[model samples]
Target: MTVRPTDRLDETVGIDTSRPHPARMYDWYLGGKDNYPVDAEMGRQMLALDPRVPVMARVNRAFAHRATRWLTEHGVRQFLDIGTGIPTEPNLHQVAQAVAPDARVVYCDNDPVVPARAAALLRGTPQGATEYLLADVREPDVIIEGARQVLDLTRPVALSLVALLHLVPDEDGAHELVDGLLSQLPTGSYLMMTHATADFTPEESTAAVERLTAAGSTVALRSRTGFARFFAGLDLVEPGVAVVDRWHPELGEPVPGRDDGTIPGYGAVGRKP
Candidate 1:
């Protein structure tokens, strides 16, 4: 693993490397070196269950890219990306700003490790503005407030919850939180999301969920119906809610093995009409 420069994060922040965090494990899956042994161990177990787990992560990320590109092309100049994960190359802002140089983006993640390397995230074009917020999605008020600093809440902003909702169970009021955040935005704002699901591989997905919950990470993989409910009252884009690979594949390259194996996820883009 290549040793990338750490961002020399704030010392007061709390980061527990003792247990595996979803962000770190996700980084590990993406062939990044930011994760610890605990994260790799859990990721290995997940891979053992389904060797295509890494492919699923990549597919979900690709969905985010295509959705961001579509939103930018559709004239969305502001973005609020929660569960922004580690600072992967060609991030949401990269994809958006590539189309609109002045795009403003707010990236939020619960992981301190991500902020530890947020400098890479801040390296956007001078015409654009990018900021990282260390907050949890369960608290939408805090996220919305922090996002307002960089993004104009009155404008049409794309609220991206890509590969995030599974971490927040229904008991945690995930639907209510999304509604609250959307309530703060204006009409024509978009909601772009990709979620893990058990509809394809029920038995394996359930086992993976149990294992993740056992390791202190909640994986509330939703079904097609449950995932669609998040966009209730909003106008779904063409093709409606579909699998990650099926949602606007023309906008981005397809992930290998995404179809050979069940991706176990749903991706969609909706306009707040």
Candidate 2:
């Protein structure tokens, strides 16, 4: 179920062409035309550092699909997804609604371009509700308030950070932010995440981060142990914190370029005890 962007897209939604955005750059990685030349240029620079950047994007997305499916299959019917990029095929609502038609989803992102594309995200099943929030993850209160309008915080909700945290630096209190959000949910709620790491290729990863930072994009590559600490108190699922492709492989099709080398990212799902 591929989602089409709104025809009413306004390019002036605070979009900055002078610097690259992680969302638009991600769109480029997925081969979508939503990105600008600046984004493409930065993406090419990252590619030069590691030719598998695009492949890593696909692998990370595939991990999201698998984790969402796993949660919905386990009886989670509501979702609070922060940092949702351009609405790609089988958006969170679509994936959840496929398993449970009444699933409700609230997507939040600070990206100016994301709200402009909310039309596609809103096209969920009649039995469910899908809403997008034009807010940043740093403002947890704002995101939670917006999400409360669409989801029942009293019930179990999957808080999907996905690939968003690596962009948030420790100086920003990344762990504190996660804790603040989790505090608002019930005991049965879950956290689904994937983040880029320097554990595998420290040298190239450092250079890539420097380049992206020079381009005005914030990048904070963490260690494998650092990634594991995000799920500190929660109970991890089986085969914990493996490379994106190695987690629950039976849930999705194979992504290309995975066998070449370490994918430089990690994905995992953890439940609040």
Error of 2 at 170 (Å): 0.5
The collision pairs in model 1 are none
Candidate 1 on 92-171: residue-level lDDT in tens?
88898899989988888888878657755457778888787788898888888777777788889999999999888899
By summed lDDT, the worst window of 10 consecutive residues in model 2 runs over 1-10
Q: Model 1: residues >4 Å from true position, as ranges?
A: 1-11, 257-259
Model 2 segments beyond 4 Å from truth? 1-12, 120-122
Model 1, position 245, has a per-residue lDDT of: 79
Every model: Cα RMSD to truth:
3.8, 3.1
Question: So what's the TM-score on candidate 2?
Answer: 0.94
Model 2, 189-241: lDDT tens digits are 99999999998899999999899888877878888899998999999998898
